[model samples]
Every structure is written in structure tokens, then in C-alpha cells.
Target: MELTDLRKMRGKQIAVTNGLILTLLTIYFVMISVLDVTFSVLFLILGISILIQAILGFLKSDSTKSFIPIFEQVANYEKQKMGREWNKQRRMGFIWNLILSGLMFMQYYFSRGSTDHVFQIDFTFMFVITLIALGLINISLFLHIRKVDRSTSELDMKGYTWKSSLVAVVVGVVLAVASIAFIMFYILSNL
Candidate 1:
């Protein structure tokens, strides 16, 4: 493979790993909240790392020549139209993360102070399961991005093979869902 191809592959791998880490941290947050577990700062660091990786991935993708012209054109037109809305969405994501983190910390403090408080066992279990499902969805998205990157690389080297990319996407999504379901069930049963 060419150096550029390798770089793209590496970036895709990093992005996927970051996505998995983000999903796991989100699941941890939900589990802690529902079960009244103590909040760990480590999850905050992980979440931040995920966000950093996501930004890095986006920047790296944009650095490629293929996307630059299109991005420039979009920027020129959107700057006068939807730029503020786009910025708002970005700000909202950051704000939501901050709020969630703060809430988790507050919950931890409260739970720590009141050991006698009864936690809802069923709801805790359900929350964890649902978070796992959401994690799987994110993982599926990451895998899809990776598959598309790899397919594009392969096409550049070995000519077009439409079926390969399609198959990769399908398999990646299937595995992501199956893994999530298995993990959720296992965690629920054990809890």
C-alpha cells in the first residue's frame, strides 16, 4: 500500500478506536447514574480524548485534496446562510457533554451521602442495556466510515470493486450490533 493509503487506514483505525472508547464511557456514565455508582474522573478524560480524536479525524479528512474544493465551495455559500446554525450545533454538543458530566458528578455526590436511598434495580439494568444499544449504533457508524475509507483506498489501487465495500459495511454493522447485544445481555444478567 502507498504511504497515503497507510495513513488513511491508520486514521480510520484511530477514529474507530476513539468511537469505541467514547461509547464505552457513555455507557459507564449511564450505568453510574442509574445504579448510583461513584463517578470516576477517568471517564471524563476518556470522553475528552474521544472528542479530540473525532476532531483530529475530521481535520485529517479535510486535509485531503479530494475534500478541500468541495468544502471550500460549501463554506463560501454556507457562510452567509447556515454558518451560525452549524456553529450552534457544535456548541450544543459541547454544552450537552458538560451538562451530562456535571450531572453525573452531582449524582455521585448525592449517592455517596445517602447510602440508604433505594436504587431502582430494573431501571438501572434497562438504562445500561439501552446505553449499550446506543454504543453499538455509534460503533456501527465508525465501522461504516472505516469500511468506506478502506474501499476507497482499494479502489485507488486495484480498481473498482463495488461488492467489496458493500460487503464490508454490512458485515461491520452486523458484528457491531451482535457484539452490543451480547455485551448488554451479559452485563444485565450479571448485575
Candidate 2:
């Protein structure tokens, strides 16, 4: 195959994988919202499903060993494709997050004025912490977009550097930790 054809195949592969995952998530969320399952049962099922998913993800990556350096090449192709669609996606994310955050702040403000201690306690310190952690998520997304924007036509690791890779790893870890902390905080607070 020509070099361009190879790159196009890889890019399409990555896009297909991402699309499938998003489709599954959408289906899962829709099902969960429609079901009236108890919290304990839901949590148990979610935990087990997540564990299975991690194992499957590992196996999939292992099986695709021939597709080495997925990060570098896949990113370059996606970046090239990230034209108006990416801009639209970014704008939608910003608008949705802004509206969600505004609703959260409104809830917190109203809770404080109410005499109900339960609601007030629920939305107090942890809520603020969650909001701050959300900034980390936004930062990670921005970092990804910046990296995509910096993608160059030259392949073979010509554009990416060790420092940038390290920064990406650090940001990813921070986002993961923040996400776990938020989940834990929510569980504990609700209990």
C-alpha cells in the first residue's frame, strides 16, 4: 500500500474504535436512566463491568501489537482531519459544561439558604472541590487539542518530544486521580 493509504487505514481504524466506544456509552447511559435499579446492585454491576472492560482493553491493545506507536500516527491523522468538526465539538463541550456548572452553582446557592441541613451538607465543600477538579479535566482536553494542533506531517516521531509526552502522561494521571477522587467523594457524601 502507498504511505498515504496506510495512514488513512490507521486513521479510520482509530475513528471506528472511538465511535464504537461512544455508541456503547450512549446506550449504557440510556439504559441506566430508564432502569430503576438499586444503588448497591448498580454499583456492583458497574464495578464488574469496568473490570471486564479493562481486561478487554488490555487484550485488544496486545492483539494490535503490529499497530505500534498508535499514539503518534493516529494523532497525526486525526489532527489533519480535525477541521470544522473539532471546532464544533469543542464549542459544544464548552457550552454544555458551562450550563452544567451554572446549574450546580445555583443548586449550591439555594441549598445554603434552605433550612435543610442534608442538602446543605451535600453541596458544601465537596461540591466546590468537584468543580475545581473539573478544571483539571478541561485542562487535559485543552492539552489534547493543543497537541493535535501541533501535529505535523512529518512522521517517525519527528514532531513529538520526550517533554511533551511526559507532560501528557502527567496530565492524564492527574485527570484520572481527580476523577477517582470525585467519585469517592460522592459516594462517601451520599452515605
Candidate 3:
């Protein structure tokens, strides 16, 4: 509700998400080759960066929620503008995270293939960069929120109504079935 509470919540979200990201990446690296010293060091650095960010975020707490006086009322349209700005940042984060996740899945799948990967450096570097970006996304979002309105930036108007949710579900299911059918068709046709 208040920015102070929101900051703490965001700090937790950042720490937890970044921790999980590191864990997943570490697991993948281990599965590929547990004893690779080069990658192990890189992972350690990434872990440290995430840890420091989390600590800084946790320590930096805002005491006051509103820059405006307590008695001042935020205009309705300014409230809408803040809502829109926060939502925009949220959407950006979600889109980028999804993109990075897809890239990671593709890398994981290909890395397990029989052929030796000649482009390992190129692909791995991209994945690592994207992973870092994903981990820092929360901090970027927090900055964006602070810019919008310290008091209410963390507050969200429900972007999705029930009707919109149902439509999204239907579209998702349709796309999934079509993708599966297409894959089956390709395999069967090749056979």
C-alpha cells in the first residue's frame, strides 16, 4: 500500500527471483559440465552481484510515502497517469523475461543435442547477458516506479478484467493445440 511497504516487498521479490535465476543457471551449467572452472567463476560473480543488489535494496527504505503533503489529494488523471506508467514498466519486464526464458529453453535444448556446439560462446554469452538483464529487471522497475509517484507507484489497478482473462485463456489454448498439431504433422510428414 505505502511505498515503504512496497519497497520491502519489491526487495524480497528481487532477491527471490534473482536467487532462483542464479540457481537455475547454475544447475544448467552443472548439468553441462560441473568442473568447468571458467563458467563456475562467472556464476560466482553473477551470484555476488545479485546478492549485493538485494542487500542494497533491502537497506534502502523510504520513510515517507508521499512527496506531496499528507492532506493533498492526487488528481484523478495523475493517478491514472501513474497507473499507466507502472503498468507499462510491468509489461516491459514481463515481455523481456518471457523472451529470455525462451532463449534459455532453446539453448538448453540445443546444448543437449548430439552435435558438438561450435557456436557455444556466441549463444552462451547472449544467454548470460539476457539472464543478467532479467535479474536486474526488478531494480529497473523499482526506479521507474519511484519516478512515477513515490507514494502510489507500487499500487496497481487491476489491468485484467474477468472477460479479458477468459479471452486470453482461450487464445492460449488454441495456439497451443495448433502448435502441437503442426509439430505432429511435420514429424508424420517427414516419416
Candidate 4:
């Protein structure tokens, strides 16, 4: 496919994914708000940041200008490298998700003490549903990346940057750390 075609497809995917992410964020915010306002707000900010990044990715120009041809070349090289790495990382993520799902299921099953303290059905249902949604999202992202990798040459001509992936990794790590910290704090406060 042509660069324009690939760009259009990616743009559409980004928009749809961003919309779903926003919806999930809304649900998460509601659930957390019931538990703790502080933790909820922290997650709300993170979700908003993700939404903004997704919007930027979707709106980024695909056209290459003569004035910055060298920059474009560098970006193309980086995208190619990042694409290969991303493919490998995503394969691992898929496997990990499957393992995690199995573990969570087992934990839920084995932790049941009695009917009196039976896991809250609502929480259990939501937990499973959320895990499924996350798994699906990751799978969708993996497929999208695969499609993009197949069309990388076409996209490279348009000056797509692979450095974005590196940046995303750093930002994702920071956000994850912050999320873990917040969860810990929330748990401690409640206890």
C-alpha cells in the first residue's frame, strides 16, 4: 500500500483506540473515585496524558518537507529500528498477558474460603472484564504495529519517527511506576 493509505489507516486506528482508551479511563476514574479521590485524580491525569499523546499521534503530519529532509531520513532509520524491537516486545507481551490471565483466574478460584466470605461477585466480574479488555487492547495494538511494520517503507518516505516509540517506553515506565506508588499509598491509607 501507498504511504498515504497507510497514514490514513493509522490515523483512523489511533482515533478509535484513543476513544476506547478514554472510555476505559472514564470507567476507571469512576471506580477509583468510589475508593479514593486522590488516587482517582492521579489516574485521571495519567489517562488525560495518554489521550493527548494519542491525539498528537493521530494529528501528526505525514508529509515530508524539503527543508528537513535530513531529519526525515534520521526519523526513517529510527522508525525501522524501533519497529523491529516493538514487534519482538509485543510478542513477549502477548505471552505474558496469557500467563497473567491464567494466574489471576487461579488466584480467584483458590482464594474462595466459603460462601460467607466469597469474593465479591461484582468486583470479580469487573476484574475479569477489565483484564479481558486490556488483553484485547494489547492484541489490537500488536496487530496495528504489525501492519505498520509491513508498511514501514511507505511510512518512512513520509518521515515517520521511530523515536516516538522510545519516548513512549520511557513515559510508560514513569506512568507505571507512579501508578504502582499510588496504589500502594491507597492500600496503606485504607489499612
Candidate 5:
């Protein structure tokens, strides 16, 4: 494929993936609304971010200026480099979605009998598992980007550093511990 064709292909990949995510998020938001559940601010932030991404994805796919910075960088690459990294780029989004689905499945399986709202569905366990899953996903993305950086000369991308990964780990652990402690305090105080 020509360089322009390769860029278009990448743009389409991004658009399709973002579109799927937007659909799923819309479903989730609707479900929570129907159930009268109070959602975290995180969901609002994520929803807005996904909405922006979907719009940017569509623009990129239309061969317009890519609002996403990464795609703009990728556009500078030669067709050969772009082609070589295409498979990895395509797979990364799918793998991330799969991993998240798996985590959600595990959470559902463990909390199956509860008819409670989503928040009370063994959330502490799910929260910790989610933290771990996100960490692993981040590491995987870091490695993928690092590999791509090694081959491409057009982009001077800095992949995730070990220190950043370590910091992420530390923060996740701290959050998990704090959440657990808060849950414990709530239970004990009620008793």
C-alpha cells in the first residue's frame, strides 16, 4: 500500500475501535441509568473522553487532520514502517477490550447470586482485580510501543519507563488498600 493508503488504514482501525468503545460505553451508561445507580465521576470522565476519541477517529478516517497526536506522528512514517506495525496496532485495541471483558466476566461469575446494584456486586474484589488487570494492560502496551519504537525512525516516542510502571504499581496497591480499609471501616461502624 502507498503511504497515504497505509495512513488511511490506520485511521480506519482507530475509528472502528473507538466506535465500538463508544457503543459499549453508551450501553453501560444507559443500563446504570435504568437501574437508578449512582455512578462514579470516573464514568463521566471516561464517557467524555471516549466521545472525543470517536469524533477524532471519524475525522482521521475521513482523511482529515487527525486530532489524535499519535496518529499524526504515525502519519510521518514511511509505508514500510507503518505496514510493519499495523498488525500490532490493530491487535492492541482488540486485546485490551478482550482483557477488560474477561475481567468483567470474572467479576460477574464471582458475584453471580447477588441481585444488588452493580456497585454492591463484590466491588472490592472487582476493584482490586481491575487494578491488576489495568496494570498488566499498561505493561503490555508499554512493551508493544517499545518494540515499535525500536523499528521506526520517523517517531521519537518514549515508551513507558520502568519507573513509571513501578509508580503505577505502587499507586494501584495503595488505592486497593485504602478502598479495602474504607470498606472495613464502614462495615465495622455499622456493626
Candidate 6:
């Protein structure tokens, strides 16, 4: 086969295998949850299924380009600008969470002897701390988005094709609504 044909074949293989593996995963989770099953020999079936899937994924993704690396390459822009910012922002978020945790702990620890607690205990302090934590999270998220946008300013990395994207979204919404309806019907009928 010509190089072009080989590339096309690989792309098709990748798409098909990717779709199948993900669908299997969705089915596995849904069945496990819906049937109220647990760890057993049946789980071995899930394991083997996933192993086969990984092999198929590796086979299809053997070419120079893979999904994650492509996405990273797009997002990182030059020499990991977005990546560095992401790591830095992630650490900042962790630190903020730790600070929040400590503050909450202190608030609880010091107020252990108080007659009024939680909802009635220092409402202003609780509200202020909660607001600050929320604001920090929002600010960090916005900053990350800004950094990513700045990095990928020039490159138009359209992750999905317009038609397929639309179709996928519509199908997902339909499935979700239908599943909810089915579940409600089942519950109501049982009642």
C-alpha cells in the first residue's frame, strides 16, 4: 500500500478501536452500577476486555502521532508554556486547598467548647472563608484559561469535526434523556 493509504487505514483502525473500547467501558460501568454487582470472577472479564482494548489502542496508535501527545503539543505551544503554567497553577490550587483545610480545622478546633456551632458559630468568618476559597478557585481557573488561550493563540486546534461533534452531542443528549425517562418509568412502575 502507498503511504497515504497506509495512513488512512491506520486512522480508520484507530477511530474504530477507540470507539469500541470506550463504548465497552461505558457499558461495563453502567451494567456494574445498574445491576449492583461487585468484585468477582466476572470482574476478570472486564479486566480481560480492557486488556484487549489496550492492545488494540496501542496497535492503532503506533504511528508518530497519538491523541494525548497531540493535545499536549497543541496546548503547550512553545516549549511547554501552558504546561508550566498549568503545573504552577495546580500547585497554587493545592496550596490554597491546604490553607482552606487548615483554616476550617482551626475554626472547628477553637470552637469545640462553644455552645453555638457550625451554622450558628461565627457566620461571618465561615462565610468569608468559604467565599475566599471559592473566589481563589475561580480566579485560578480563569487564569489557566487565559494562559491556555494565550499559548494557543495562533494554532486553531479544532478537536472535533463540526458535523461529527454535533452528531455526538445530540446523540449523547438523547441517550441521557432517554435513560432518565426509562429509569423514572421503572421506578414509577415499581412503586
Residue-level lDDT tens digits of model 2 in 149-168: 45543342242444454675
| Model 1: per-residue Cα lDDT over 61-92, one tens digit each | 42323343443433343233333443443344
- Could you give the C-alpha RMSD of every candidate to the true structure, in order shown? 12.3, 14.2, 13.5, 14.4, 11.1, 17.9
Runs of candidate 4 with Cα error greater than 4 angstroms are 24-94, 114-178, 186-191
Candidate 5 CA-lDDT value: 0.51
Model 3: lowest-lDDT 10 consecutive positions: 69-78
* Span of 10 residues, lowest total lDDT, candidate 5: 154-163
lDDT tens digits, residues 1-191, model 6?
34464345445544554555456645754565456443432333444444454455445432223465533333333224333444333344344444444554555455545544112223454344445545544554344335444444323322213433365468658867976786577558757
lDDT of each: 0.51, 0.51, 0.48, 0.50, 0.51, 0.45
Q: 3 or 5, which is superior by TM-score?
A: 5
Please identify model 6 stretches exceeding 4 Å from their true place: 1-81, 120-143, 152-191
Q: TM per model? A: 0.31, 0.36, 0.33, 0.35, 0.35, 0.28
Stretches > 4 Å off in candidate 3: 34-114, 118-139, 147-191
Task: Indicate the residue-level lDDT of 97 in model 4.
Answer: 45
Q: How well does candidate 4 match the true structure in TM-score terms?
A: 0.35
lDDT string for model 3 (37-63, tens) is 443344444455544544543343322
Separately for all candidates shown, the number of backbone clashes (residues 3 or more apart, or on different chains) is 0, 0, 0, 0, 0, 0
The residue-level lDDT of candidate 1 at 2 comes to 58
